[model samples]
Target: MRAAIAGSDAVRGTTSPNPPVGCVILDAEGNQVGLGATQPPGGSHAEVMALVDAGTKARGGTAVVTLEPCAHHGRTPPCTRALIAAGVKKVVFAVADPNPAAAGGRTVLTDAGVTVESGLLADEVELGPLRAWLHYARTGRPHVTWKYAATLDGRVAAADGTSRWISSEESRAQVHDLRRRIDAIVAGRGTILADDSALTARSADGTADGTSVDRQPLRVVVGTGDLPEGARVLDDAAETLHLRTREPSEVLAALGERGVVDVLLEGGPTLAGAFVQAGAVDRVLAYVAPTLLGDGPVALGASGVSTITGAHRFRVEGVTMCGPDVRISAVPDRN
Candidate 1:
């Protein structure tokens, strides 16, 4: 199962709207025979690929997969059918299929005389590479990860609004790597007017590594303000969407319908405040610099929490040092 999870991680960015699944095949003697991962959208599923790699060795063998074999047919045939026809003796899976149309794979396999075992390293599989798609399937909304950089005193910009390079170059590079994984990158019209950021997933030197990124994420601008004709986000590097709304739920719902599983929110303070106040933010990626700006704009605008009792709490998931800056990752504490 661990090997299966590793296979899932290898193709994370390319399989949006579909979980990046992994599979490993073992012969009757329990020796690993083949390994496979989900291909890009409309390509072969992980199980089929593994079966093909195993060939005759797949008959009477056990299959270990990160996600349950898909039971329904969409762009391809049902994975359960494939496994049954391949004469697999048993199946072990990590996570259950959350889609209603694709559920019940376990029943299908069990009824076909194949032993089925579930929840093997399930937490690791669900929270690791499949986190975004599982969240989207359960909530019917894209998982939003709000990312920002601020000073030691929590200032995003200086008092004069000249916010340039608050965090180190290393932290900025990490953001580009993150941008390559998500389905869309969103900002407000205010940010577009102020920074005119290109928002493409590129290195600090402004070059896209074609080998890793076949397509750039969708660039999105939200708000009622009109954008200039030559906004950098409107460049032909990638398709751009102007939502013309300030509500976070509306933006997420629209993106969800478009098959967007994850969203990277690069919006400004006011827009970030709206998402926070609306409880739309699922995760937070904050980079804290060592410098202090006593009087300047904070990282987020008013979130309507007047007192400490009403404060939004987050549980720290990780803390790391990126050059001279500290990168903190957290998720909302809903307890």
Candidate 2:
């Protein structure tokens, strides 16, 4: 199941705007029979592709999938029907679908007398194919990741405004890796004005790699403010939107309405403060340089969540050292 589930990560960057999905099939003897993962956009689903490969053998077997087999019709016919036709005796799933049209697919199966189970590999499934979709289901919004590269002391740039690379090549490559999975990347006026970034998800080769080509994420700059004369961000503004505003939640809501399933925030401290304070930052990825800048800057500044009760608190999730840079990740505490 873990090997089958891990396959979903390959399709995450391509599946976004669409949901991430994965599938596995078992033989009557309960041995692994066939497996398929969603390919880039316009590719066949894991179940459909697996069934295609499994042929007549899929009958009388169990299908283990990361998500509830989608019931409502879309690019393909309902998965529940497909599984039934394939004679999959049982279905095991990690998470329930929240789409109103497809929400009851599991019930449909169980009612048909097929052995159905939910939440079997829920955590692993979430970390795999259903990750982004599960995030949307839980919060009515996609999982948001805020990333920043700060100086030795954590300053993004000196108050004097000399902003070049703070972290090493390894750390920068890691940032590009994060860019691949997100539906879009956001920044405030200050970030755009100071650093004109070409926020596209480029490969380590510095060339465009568009597996799910049309999945090009909207490059969002949040402000109607004029940009520098030769600002790179403005050059690509046609693929983005600039909304002058102070309300972070409103901006997030607007983006959500536009089919932005997930967002990556590449910013300095101010916007991070706003997002974290609003209870909007689901995760923080910070890359800390080993050297010290004395009083330069830090990854996080003063948070803006109201009162101690409203403060943004996180439980450390991971710590990784890449060269001289130490990467730390934190998740919002449910409490």
Candidate 3:
């Protein structure tokens, strides 16, 4: 199951609308035979790929998958049918398929006399690779992760408005890797005007030369202001979209229409505050440097929290050291 989860994580950015599932096949003697992850859209699912890899070895074998094998026919045939045809005898899955159309795979397998078991490392799978997709399935919107880097005093920029290189090199590399795994990178027009950021996910070693990776997430700029013709985001590094709207929900809706499942909000403090005020932020990824800047722009602008009771609180999910910086992951605390 852990291997399956890792496989799922490996292909997170490629599959959208379709869950990025992972599967491993073990022969009758319990020796691992094959492993695979979901392909891009309109491609074979994870089980089919793994079965193809297993070939004749799949007969009477056990299949361990990150997500329940989908049982419905969408872009391709149902995965349950493929598993049955592969002659797999037992299936162990971490998380059940949440889509109404994709659910009931266990039943299908059981009806075919295949042993089916679920909830093996379910929480890990759900909270790890499946987190954004599950949220998109339950809600008809993209999952938003607001990302920001600031000093220990919560200052995103210095007093002179210079905000370059706040986080350590390791943290920046992690951010670039994260940018490669999501559907889109969202920022406001103000950020584009001020930073002139390319917003492209570049190779870890090519950051100095500005060489982008093979797969770059969609760059989305939101706001009514006009972007300069020479803006770096307008280059050919990746696809760029000008939303021409300041509403966070509207931006998300537009991206959702484009089949975006995960979003990294990289906008400035004002834009971040707007999303916060609209209650649209789903997760928060903060990178805090050890240094402190007493006078500078904070991480967030006016967020409509007039009273202390109205503060938007969040539960810290994790804290880790990224070189000299501290990285924190948190989600909103609605309770």
TM-score of each: 0.94, 0.86, 0.97
Query: Which one is best on TM-score?
Result: 3
lDDT of each: 0.91, 0.75, 0.91
Q: How accurate is candidate 3 locally (lDDT)?
A: 0.91
- Candidate 1 to truth, TM: 0.94
Q: Pick the winner on TM-score between candidates 1 and 3.
A: 3
lDDT per residue (tens digit) for residues 1-335 in model 2 = 67557766666766655576777788899877788777655666777877776778899998888778877777767788888988889998877887786778888798777899889878877755666667777677767789887765767766666655678778877777777667788888777876677677765555566663334567887766766677776664237777677467887888878777778988657777778877788788888877655565555556765478766678888899977898998888886
Model 1 spans with C-alpha error above 4 angstroms? 206-212
Worst 10 residues of 3 by lDDT: 203-212
Name the candidate that leads on lDDT.
3
Summarize candidate 1's per-residue lDDT along 272-333 as a digit string, tens digits. 99999999999999999999989988889888899999998999988999999999999999
| CA error at residue 260 for candidate 1, angstroms | 0.4
Clashes of each: 0, 4, 0
